[model samples]
Target: MRFTLKQLEYFVAAGETGSIARASERIHVSQPSISTAIAQLEKELNVQLFLRHHAQGLSLTPSGRTLFQEAKRLLEQAGGLYAAASQMHEEVHGNLNLGCLTTLAPMILPELTLSFTSAFPKASVSPLIDHQERLLASLRRAEVDIAVTYDLRLSEDVTFQPLVELPVHALVGENHPLARESRTTLKELAALPLVFLDLPHSRDYFLSLFDMDGLTPNIAYRLTQPDVIRTMVANGFGYTLVNTAPRSNVALDGRTLTRVAIDGSHRPMTLGLATLTALRQTKLLEAFVSHAKSIISQGYIPGMMAP
Candidate 1:
């Protein structure tokens, strides 16, 4: 009346792939073996995991869905466990789900991926890029093991480890009048037309920068994508505020753009890594954190400038 790990593994594969035959082919196990394992799993759990049709394959029942999530988690944890144990030999082997802030993704994630993957050959890295809210949600749901983002609207359920500091700066077209300034003030920049990056917490951060000075931007355009904001600024539509500086001053239209320093009083945004407090500190996560800390500390991460 006991189901084995093999049964659970096969059951999960069948449930996910939607057919015992496909699961068999995918796992390189015989079809009959997969079926028997699934049958044994159902009997041991005293629940019907799937409803089968003549040729249509299989569909999960309510119990099957519940077990599917748990089984997937367990399998991931099992992989992590073996990988963790393997770290003694200076090798990392596991699957990691990484989330990154959409704005910082271009600057940081690539650096992390190139170095981390090269160092750990057996490890697989999957990326999920989104806003702070979405990234935090993924961390809570265990959909992401770690996140690279700014410290915005964070709750106590997650921990943010500060990595680098990138203060807000003004982006303007090369032809714009402000592009000639060596340093500018919030009030001075507020008077110009603003093409805002209207993302979740990021928007709030940009808008909140003016609070101390009692200034507000002259709203001209609103957008979600970062590149579009840059393009807008390059086209001379309006100026925009952003954290990281683009590696190139040229926009998509081949027009040049420029970033001028803001006054010293403005607060800088801190880039950090976030992880759920509830998730255990696995070796894989620790390795990633260590590598990230090394990268940031060395000052090689592109687009990010030290305060």
Candidate 2:
């Protein structure tokens, strides 16, 4: 016999509440409508479901008990269909592979993970840290769903969404002469000891600032890690340029370091989210991207100076 979902829902409601009037109230239908549907269901199955008395509402017979159990299961399955459809509307579950650069990853990933996990609990998030070249390649190959990287030398295959404008700050030891300066120009900074990130992409980007200002950087050291640069700067070694400003607690030794802002409009290094143009966005990726964008807009991004 062909039984509709409405009939099964009516049966479960009646079985649970033990009254047609109460079942109709729960299902938001008229009592007569629910009673007629249940009656039609039992008639179609060629069985007597309810033992209705003059005063009592309704009681399940032996066959009614079996059908009522099956009706509950069917209702649950129907509810699952609705739930699955709703989940599709909001990207609730899927694998999201994301990557971040070394410098920004340490600063941003912790907060991002904590907040995003709470928001999209069903999503499985796998985060990786790598240089820009490898990260961009991963995005192109659809290995990583998204990447957070410096907005310099971006590839065409990757689409970028600006997350934050990270101010480039000069790291100098406490004893350095320019450390006392409230803010110094790139030209003045060029005269001091300079260190590059030593990575090919970043090396060129860092050197170009000096080259654009028509001054040669006084090359003193080449380092890859930001912490190494911070260590050298704190020990009164050569100063280095970095986009993300480190916290005061994250200093080297007891000597406090200084952040000297450039005089002119320096390259505003943007930390942006990148995703492959080709890959179809899953539910998790969409939710993550939405949450990330909201967090960034809400001023959650680190190194954002108060207005």
Candidate 3:
């Protein structure tokens, strides 16, 4: 025998509110209608759903408790279905779970999130900050819909759309000698101690910059977090390389760090939006990607200049 979702919903609501009148008010149906629907649902399922007493409004039987759990799940799924249907309209109105590499998260996420929230007021966005490899794994597992990461050696299971070309810059403290240079070469900056982000992929990417110039920079400090590197640099401890300047105002004792140009003819890192090849593109995801691409393309003008 088949049972209707409406019946399960009525039963669950009645169980929750503990009164037919309250359930009717919550579900926007009459108390008699709610009572009849739950009674019919219990009879159809061959279970005693509610234990009714004169003073007490309602309580669930043992079988009723199990049915109530399943009913709640069914109601949640039904709500998701309704939301998906409603999102077919122009405005995006669903949950968007996106992941981003640590490097890009600080530089690019705030603007994208602001614009998305303004445009799709009904939609909710959840951002996951992780390293490149982990984000890629999440995309493969379908845990996240989209990721912003460097367009490196990606598997055939994923598709990458190049969104921005960000020139790598050298981050140095105000007192550091290199901070005063108009344009500096890697060979010149090689003498300074380098603090690495400690990620394999990022280390490879950073090392490749020096390798292209046929030189190796001195390594003194190794860390994974940008803030750690930033703090160290501010104290005149060491210098580090970054894809972009700090997006927000980063201050250390009322002094801001400086991002200087790096010379020696290195290629800009191609930051891309990646999605799974096997997954069907949802409208909300497509819209989000489109907006992101647009913002990245227009926001940062490409040219050779000091930061």
Candidate 4:
């Protein structure tokens, strides 16, 4: 083989990211190194792998797409060989590409990832935080090996292992009229302004709670960032629905907030691990899965309030 695995790895990164600069950021290699590797690989392979677009970035050529698929397969096989060796030694090693829901990441990832790595010092985790749709897409594309997310609109190609149930809560400013209440109904909240967490599947799930009762919330603000939504709620902008309640009742701006359980039974989101159904679970992945199952349970979770 004229080209090395390092060159193939760089080529694959460029193909996936569609830009040498972005690829460099992804793989922690310098842009020049990635560029040189790609140039060397193309020279050895005797093919034009990418069509450069001025200021727009790179795109795979027809042959490049085919080779990209094979390159990804080869990388997976190489990872499998490493996994096999680790299994022989009965040790967990290598990097676990973990995807997490953006809303849950801050509360869950730090504790969860740190503990796992501490337990298995040889294994490290790289986290990608995003919304539901993108997380699922990442699983399909093998961009992430496992995703700690909600079981929301999961496709047939993905498998979800339920970890715990997180029921919906009405988040409000401490001084809000309903804040004193232990629990509230959707009907009562429908009349008031709502600070909506406007993400793909998350938006639908929150709205569905009202839809189930044939009601709609008077949406006052639609925000993407969870902290921003919490701060808005703390400032009495409006109440928002959240599944995972942080350990603290105070928002980032130092304003107090309240978490009131939604009255009656509603569809609680199931927090779980999601992965591609077709992908074989490596020994490292198995170890992480076991650790996750042990830590995340009904009565206890790492960063969030007890369920």
Worst 10 residues of 4 by lDDT: 85-94
Comparing 3 with 4 on TM-score, the higher-scoring candidate is 4
- lDDT by residue (tens digit), candidate 3, 159-219: 9998767788888888888878767778877888887778758888888888978889899
**Which predicted model would earn the best lDDT?**
4
Candidate number that wins on lDDT, 2 or 3 = 3
Report, for every candidate in turn, its global Cα lDDT versus the true structure: 0.86, 0.80, 0.81, 0.94
How do the residues 163-199 of candidate 1 rate in per-residue lDDT, one tens digit apiece? Answer: 8778788999999999898778888888989999888
lDDT of 2 at 16: 86
For model 4, residues 19-102, the per-residue Cα lDDT tens digits are 999999999999999999999999999999999999989999999999999998999999999999877687789999999999
How close is every model to the real structure, measured as TM-score? 0.70, 0.73, 0.67, 0.72
Measured over all alpha carbons after superposition, the RMSD of each candidate to the real structure, in angstroms, is 17.9, 8.0, 14.6, 20.2
Candidate 1: Cα lDDT at 204: 86
Q: What TM-score should be assigned to candidate 3?
A: 0.67
